[model samples]
Target: MSTIASLSRSWSSRVPAKRRDPRCAEPIDVREKRYGYFPKMFVHRGHRYEVYAVERCWTVSRRGRRDRIERHCFRVRCLEGTFELYQDVRHNTWHLQRQVD
Candidate 1:
């Protein structure tokens, strides 16, 4: 590998391929802020995670078998650390997309 590639490989953490088991859609209490739906807290795995802040937000869509799946993605910080959450409109289920390393 090149020098830059080697440096990045050693420095950066890799995204995992295996997904974790999906917890049931947690009850996210949101409030309308200046921009949009701001999540305040959510209960998952019997633990209540209070959102310290929403670091970023974005949207994504992809073609599914029946229709397009649109989702709202959020990068949020809580007591633990940063985590990515997705609200899949097609299924009306919120998913914990991934946890930042």
Candidate 2:
């Protein structure tokens, strides 16, 4: 092997692989603001629910299906007040309707 190649291999083997820091994985401020807090409600089946914001959502689709599904973590202001809640997976948009409360 060449001098350069041998040197590179020696150095690479000496270095330890970097690991993800648990603290860096999550920010303290965000944990303080949102962790352990979620909205509680019984939604009617056909009423409009006002959405203030969304925190996270995932789009999923099955094989051979033409349509995609979207799930949302939404925060909304309701008659009771504003709260964060997990919304069901609908089509492209979040469904608004009366939920049995």
Q: Could you tell me every candidate's TM-score relative to the true structure?
A: 0.67, 0.24
RMSD of each: 5.1, 15.8
The stretch of ten residues in a row with the least summed lDDT in candidate 2 is 22-31
Clashing pairs in 1: none
Residue by residue across 1-101, what tens digits does model 1's lDDT show?
A: 89999887765545244343434334443432334465667666666778888899998888879888798888999889887887777766666767774
In model 2, pairs of residues that clash are 43-99, 44-98, 44-99, 45-98, 45-99, 46-98, 47-97, 47-98
lDDT of 1: 0.69
Which candidate ranks first by TM-score, i.e. highest? 1
What are the per-model numbers of colliding residue pairs? 0, 8
